[model samples]
Target: MSAHAMKMLNTLLPALVAVFSASTFAGEAQIELKEGAGRDTVMANCAMCHSIDYIQMNSLFMKRTDWQATVDKMVNVMGAPISQDDISVILDYLTTYYGVE
Candidate 1:
């Protein structure tokens, strides 16, 4: 490689490594979900993109519609790849366990 490219890589590599290492460490910490029906579905689908702690964090204020919108955003905007069957299970789980109504 050229000296300029090597120098650029050397300068940026440490920052990149630090970012990735932090992510790995963050992922090692587990957020326990409530034990109930459809918990498995939430785990299988939601954890693919984000930490499950978000459910608990928002539980205080979230209602059924809020959970529905969040799931819709995940599937439509964020491309979560969840199936229709799993969507119903997840909505049921969230609304029943975490949401208010």
Candidate 2:
């Protein structure tokens, strides 16, 4: 190839690769929760803002009270658009599966 063509290829190829790879790294599949009571409720409500992975990860460190606080924050501070009724169901599921034993 010509010198000018080689120069353009070197510059543009890396830029194109980076633009595509960035999107791949940024987006990820949501982790599916195990089936149990209120699993559907959690999938519908909490996943609206963050991934199920967030709950799974925090479950390692948090207890029922921490999950309660997190859920409260999502609703009260972050405006999660969840209902009080659903809150109870979601809390139950989180505490049961993800909550500290």
* Per-model TM values vs. the true structure: 0.75, 0.71
Candidate with top lDDT is 1
- Put down candidate 2 lDDT per residue, 1-101, tens digits, no spaces: 99999999999999999998787546545366879999999989977777677877788888889999998999889999999999999889989998886
The TM-score, computed over Cα atoms with residue i paired to residue i, of candidate 2 is: 0.71
Cα RMSD, model 2: 6.6
lDDT digits (tens) for residues 1-101 of candidate 1: 99999999999999999999898768657668889999999999998898788899999999989999999999999989999999999999999999984
Candidate 1 lDDT score at position 7: 100
Worst ten in a row by lDDT for model 2: 23-32
Cα-based lDDT for every prediction? 0.92, 0.86
Query: Candidate 2 clashing pairs?
Result: none
